[model samples]
Target chain A: MEATVKIFRFNPETDQKPHFETYTMPVESTDRVLDLLEYIKGNFDGTLSFRRSCAHGICGSDAMRINGRNYLACKALVKDVGLKIKVEPVLGLKVIKDLIVDMDPFFEHFRSVMPYFVNDEPPPAKERLQTIEERERFDDTTKCILCACCTTSCPSFWANQEYLGPAAMVNAHRFIFDSRDRAAAERLRILNDQFGVFRCHTIFNCTIACPREIEITQAIGELKNAISTGALE
Target chain B: MMQTRVVPQRGFNLDYIMFIFTRVSGLSIVLLALVGIILAMVMGARTQMDLGTLMRWTFFPNPNHVVNSDIPDVTLGWANAYWSTMQFLLIFFAFTHAANGLRMIVEDYVNRGVGQLLVRGFFFLLWLFMLITAIFVVLSS
Candidate 1:
């Protein structure tokens, strides 16, 4: 099938303003959008820039706005997007180049949530033990690959950049619900900031945009319930 | 990443509950107000009643007058009961929605610390006072 890909192009050093460029190429029905991008870069425009690692969906490095929604480039099939695909860098981030968004802000929020476990007790004689039930509590959120798809799709983040976006909240939910984690109270307190979990309006955009299929909104709701009922403490 | 220090557990923060209540009350106000307005408009059109009469009916619902009027007493009583219930709900939803909205705005824009707490507390107390006053007036009428 023939596909016309419209890509947003800009180089801060050379371009006065950003613009779109169209490239028509033959693509197989099974070809993913990332494959088409690779063909464009290799054959038509070597200057085109995008981020991709592992060429699979796991790395989550190639998340961008495809046809006005955030998706992992490697995961979206060209056939599914129709003949004309409009691509751009994800919203609410600094666009370094075509289809590439600076992820520093997203990662900064993730870090602020204290993504790692903090157990004050001395290390057990062996690894910490958890029952299967306890492990299942937060298993869903562990699938997040640090992709900014959910955060970028969030309207709350666009309105107030200071708000800890849904992605960070998901990560916090992962740790806060863990039975062995001792920092649940501290994590909850940190999230009690004015820009924290309460900012989410249950819009479900993050839940839809998540590539990992994690129930991001449900996790945030759990956090809200915990905070309201004092269950986390 | 810096390790987070465990803070002393403070039981039952009302902020989240207040937030949820504000949202629910706001939605209820919108839906209830819409129904009330539509019902009023339909009744006014059917009865050929002007806005003045409608306003008077809303502010002063007299069950005794309805009972003695030519209209069936049972029907008029039902109507009066409905009107009183609607009025009470409108007062409750309106007060809670506005008060909660003000609290949210203050918390979002104001500085975080004792100042925000004081302002929110003041708003809560004011809301309670206004709600009590409104209920008293509604019951007396």
Candidate 2:
């Protein structure tokens, strides 16, 4: 199948403004968008830059706008994108180069949630134990791979960059609902700010954009309910 | 790189407060509008009134129209009270919901920072103007 891939290209050092460049390539129906990008770089233009690790979509890199939807390029098959693929860097982030965005803002939000287990209780002899039910509590949110897809796709985050984006909230949900985590109170307090969980308006764009198929809106609703019902410490 | 730090405000978080208010006000508007429509329909049917007559009766209730009938007077009084209260609430919710919705739309197109703040401020001013005008109109009537 012959596919026309239109990608946004910009280099801050050389170009004053970003522009789109189209490349035509022979692609197999099974070929991922990432494969098309690679073909463009290797044969058409080496300057075309995009991030990709673990071409199977596990790395969460190579997330871009494919046909107006946020998706990991490695996971979006060429056949699904059809004859014309309009690829651009994810929205609401500074583009560093062609299809490459500065991920610091994304990571900053992720870090704000302290995406890690925290329990000050004296360690059990070996490791913390959790029942299957307890583990299932946050099983959905545990699938997040730090991809900016959900956050970038969110209109709330686009409005207020400070708004703790959906990815951050999902990570917070992971720890907030964990039965063994001791930092639920602190995390809840942190997320209770003006730019915190309250900023979400249930748009569900994040839910739809999620590559992991995580029910982000439902998790956010649970957070709101937890806060209102005083479920947090 | 966008800095991600919490700005600690001393009082209740406005976002949280507004988030709750928007939902509550939305529901209130829907309920009040439904009730208002039904009451209008009932009053219209009672008097065998047309749309223009119903509008006048609703907006400009003539006290003298409630002649000797105790039931008519009581029903008119109740309807007037309900209408006045709903008018006030509808204005408040309509303006608030519109302003908040506009804020979301602006945020999507405008970049975050001073631009967003300025746009939001302009929207706030517009909402305030509309609310005041609506209140004045409602109360005067």
TM-score of 1: 0.75
Off by over 4 Å in 1: B1-18, B27-92, B95-141
lDDT of 2 by residue, A9-99 (tens): 9999999999999889887899999988998989989989899989887999989999999999989997788989999999999899989
State the lDDT of candidate 1 residue by residue for A104-175, as single tens digits: 889999999899998889988999988777788889999999889999999878765778999999999999
- lDDT score, residue A221, model 2? 89
User: How much is the lDDT of residue A4 in candidate 1?
Assistant: 95
lDDT of each: 0.79, 0.80
lDDT of 1: 0.79
What TM-score do all the candidates reach, one by one?
Answer: 0.75, 0.84
lDDT of 1 at A46: 99
